[model samples]
Target: MTPSAVDLSALGQRSSAIVDQAGNLARYGMDDVAGAGVRSGESVTLQAPRTVTFPDGGSITYGALDHLGRPTGVTVHITPDMIGAGTHANASILPPGWSGNGILHNEARSHLLGRQLGGSGDLTENLETLQQAPANSPVMSGFEGQIRRVVEGGQAVDYLPTSIYLGDELVPRGITLDAQGTGGFDWYVRC
Candidate 1:
């Protein structure tokens, strides 16, 4: 399909899979993806996203989310023209299943991802708030960030379909300590 004639719905649905909160991305970590490897081992080096100005005098950006759905280190690439939500900008959400290293990011990409870090599960998603976009956008990703966006051009669209997952596994928070003091046991409680 021509870039101009791109079906916002088709594209949005094709690429939006933000649901499944407890997926692999949530389990090990998005950064652990081969391409988005951490700077070090198992240490999260998430990036704080900031909007960049498109050549057409507007702004555009993308980001990733931590297990808690918080924005991590990443940025979606913006085409010089159609990549911003400024006062005079036009935008649309690409469908789900359309992950290319070009202008969009997949769950594995270290650059940008769209997870709903904050929002009412039903509505009032935070990603939309950050972009100052319409709630009905096809690129908002629902809450899991399935694929949603709002355009200044005033075309009606629906957000990409979304499904969230929950990880029931929990890790015990603990600290091991050993003391060389006169305790009967060599590894007695230090605290």
Candidate 2:
């Protein structure tokens, strides 16, 4: 026979051991507690947003902010099924599946998930700060729109995709797709 009432205190104590964004209660395999399940030598999967062309002809795409708790490279998946088809049961728009690597070796940055350079600046404040700055300032000129504010290692790390690079090439800072294989992932370097 077992105790009629189970003790949940142990589980409660370990709650901080993992993060549950969607309230999915289950054990996830992740080595580092700080880094979700992502780290160097680890593979991560992220869900990317749809890519849309802006009025200025530049395209805007959003995706995986972080894996575990570190900056990561993002991957976009465009499969036939993922593509949008006019079907009631199917997704109205193509859903992008973004995979990411835990480690960020690229010097270039991806603004997909950037934390403000300041300790407490958020998107609104960062934008406001740029808005109040002189027109000649980089932030005033345009960095505001390209940068995203996110927290990493308890500090804000602004991610800028346009600045991402591989070696010396301006490539996606996160991941770049191989030219030979569309199915392959590429860092967001500006190559």
Candidate 3:
């Protein structure tokens, strides 16, 4: 059966459950930290919003911010369909102040799943912290409209034609295309 034939409602539900559980765990973990009092320069990882899977198998993972912290933005996982007839496999949009070597990817089902770096900061440091952050730490808050991106080293890739709801507005500042392709990107609330 084609991917479309598969009933994703159940999968979506399961995905939601997993996301919710992660968020709850992060909250609980944060509660412990809060009990002891949060420290400056101390970063906590919180559960992001649910991963919204598209009918075509592409998915977008939301990021979170604590009430007293800042988050860069959410991560976008694109599928082959989302990539369209693109020739290049290695592509990404890095955030501002990104000092990383390159984009990260994991191969699955003979396809390379690129992990777009979401949020802006020291790429090396942020990536390390993101990997090290507890699975139960809360995400930073108040980062709904401040996302940006810059293309890094790689062959020019086709932009994904899609629109997403970040809080209450379509992304890319009135455009519905995925402009975060193979480079540095950032996001913040627009006045």
Best by TM-score: 3
Mind giving the per-residue lDDT tens digits that candidate 2 earns over 124-180? 111110011122123212332222211111222212221122233222222211111
Cα displacement (Å) at residue 150, model 2: 27
The top-ranked prediction according to lDDT is 3
Better TM-score candidate (2, 3): 3
Per-residue alpha-carbon lDDT of model 1 for 1-191, expressed as tens digits? 11011122222212111212122112222222222211222322234434444464433333333344432222222222432232311123222222333233322211122333112122111122121122122222232121222222322222111112122111101111111112121111100
Off by over 4 Å in 1: 1-18, 21-50, 61-80, 83-107, 110-191
lDDT of 3 by residue, 7-26 (tens): 12212211111112123322
Output the lDDT of residue 170, model 2.
Answer: 22
lDDT of 1 at 99: 39
**What are the per-model numbers of colliding residue pairs?**
37, 40, 41
